[model samples]
Target: MTTEAVLDIAVQALMVAAKLCAPVLVTALVIGLVVSLVQSMTQVQEVTLSFVPKALGAAIALVVTGHWMISTIVTFTTDLYTRMPALVGH
Candidate 1:
């Protein structure tokens, strides 16, 4: 309800979002870099060569971390809900 409370909620939401996205983002970044390196070394300048690996890596990352990501978001939501009354001074 207050400025500080609103800022706190906003920061927490952003943190949760970053935490949720980190795994897949990191995977894609790494995959892209590696694919680029391999393409350079082999002189294979195919778009799908880079794209497919990054996509598959991201998909695998999502699969591996999906449950944890869901649980983390659920926990954040539940905590936010639990603090709602206090946050609203109700």
Candidate 2:
């Protein structure tokens, strides 16, 4: 493949990876922010308190988006494979 084509593919792969991870990451971010606010308000400051909620939120996000995530990855992989021959000048 040409240099530009290889870079394009790499960028696309990165975008796909970011899209796949966004849900869980956002969930954790929001949960951590809320937990931080609560801890600040109540002065509880328990590290585990922040961790548990974030973990649960991430787990929930993964569960909810699991099917979509799998389908997206599968589609990306299938498309990549289908385009390989052309990319390889076959």
lDDT of 2 by residue, 1-90 (tens): 889889988999999999999999999999999899999999998889999999899999999999999999999999999989989999
Per-residue error (Å), model 1, residue 63 = 0.8
**Model 2, clash count?**
0
Clashes of each: 0, 0
Question: What is candidate 1's TM-score against the reference?
Answer: 0.97
Model 2, runs deviating above 4 Å = none
How accurate locally, in lDDT, is each candidate?
0.95, 0.94
For residues 25-64, write the lDDT of model 1, one tens digit per residue: 9999999999999999999999999999998999999999
Report the poorest 10 consecutive residues by lDDT, candidate 2.
1-10
- In candidate 2, which residue pairs get closer than 3 Å at backbone N, Cα or C atoms, i.e. clash? none
